[model samples]
Target: MPRHVAIIMDGNGRWAKQRHLPRAMGHRRGVEAVREIVRAAGDMGLEALTLYAFSSENWKRPAQEVGDLMGLLKHFIVADIDEFVENGVRLKVIGRYRELAPDIVALIDDAVARTSENSRTTLAVALNYGAQDELVRATSAIAARVAEGSLAPADIDTDAFADALDTADMPPLDLLIRTSGEQRLSNFLLWQCAYAELWFTDTLWPDFSRAHFAQALAEYAARERRFGGR
Candidate 1:
């Protein structure tokens, strides 16, 4: 099994539109998909599952839609905390967490704290996260250390830089799947996914099921990941 897997959950609004429902309804349904995928990942024995929950660029979306998304996030954490703790799933949110509303940040902290001891699987939600932004942040920290004469520029290497990433504690990423037929990274884990196998599907987030997830894993198992070696 892949040590770590990441997903770009797309097409929530489009799924809602196709059903003649409001965008918020699609987001609400997408939450159910999140729950299913989390359980499936844990059951499959994945060490970590990183989901592209919200990107920094998502701020450009309509205010009402953004508000609705935040509401769904809060509800997901609050309603699922007990189950997550019981199932040995560790909840973690990565990104500019301080940029979030105080209440939302508090809830995120609570969820993380509540399940910190669980070791079955780590579920990382990338909220307000962007790969470019993450790289910039890491670079800034490295530069600060260099300027302080605490670190030499020549000492920096791939592993050293990776240690500064938000996912430093997580396992190396092995598979990355994007739903809704979107064939792009959309500013997700650019650094971490350097060698991950990519899988894309037209299935929208709300319609994404355990079967679809299983298919991705099966396909991953068939590939030859040489990591640049023959």
Candidate 2:
């Protein structure tokens, strides 16, 4: 079974356009999909699930859309906290969290703390995160340690760098699913998904159902991952 599944949620705007609904409504519906997937993942006994909620490039979107997303996240934070606790999902946020609005950031912290004791599954939300940004941040932190004389440059490698990133504590990713028929990575998990099996589907984010999730899982199980070696 795929223990850790990472998702690149795509095609919300397209979904809205297809329905003649405003883009904001699409985001709202996507929240429902998020809810369903989390429950489905819990039922499936997934050890960890990481979602690419917002990427660095997402900031370039229209101001109104961005504001709507923030509002939705705030609502989600409040609405899901209890559900997370009840379902034994440990909530964790990974990325440039300081970039979020102060209130939203506080809510994220509160939810994480409240669900910290849960042991069923770890739900990691990647907000304001970009793969290249993560790499740069990790490299800078490591370099600073070397400058302070506590770390040696020669002693640093993949293990040292991995510990500096936000998802350091998590296990290697097994499967990654991107909806909306998107075949490109779009700079999601640069380091952690080094060997993960990729599954892409045309279903929009709001339309991604439990069966869609199952299909992705099945696809992942069929792949023969060589991890860069034959």
By TM-score, the best candidate is 1
| Cα lDDT of model 1 by residue, 1-230, tens digit | 79999999999999999999999999999999999999999999999999999999999999999999999999999899999999999988889977999999999998999999999999999999999999999999888989999889999999889988999999999999999998999999999989999999999999999999999999999999998777
| TM, every model | 0.98, 0.97
Could you tell me how far off, in angstroms, the CA of residue 62 lies in candidate 1 after the best superposition? 0.7
Q: Write model 2 residue lDDT over 61-141, tens digit each, in one string.
A: 999999999999999999889989998999999889878899998999999999999999999999999999999999999
Residue 68 miss distance in model 2 (angstroms): 0.6
List candidate 1 segments past 4 Å from native. Answer: none
Least well predicted 10-residue stretch by lDDT in candidate 2:
218-227
Clash pairs, model 1 backbone: none
Please identify model 2 stretches exceeding 4 Å from their true place. none
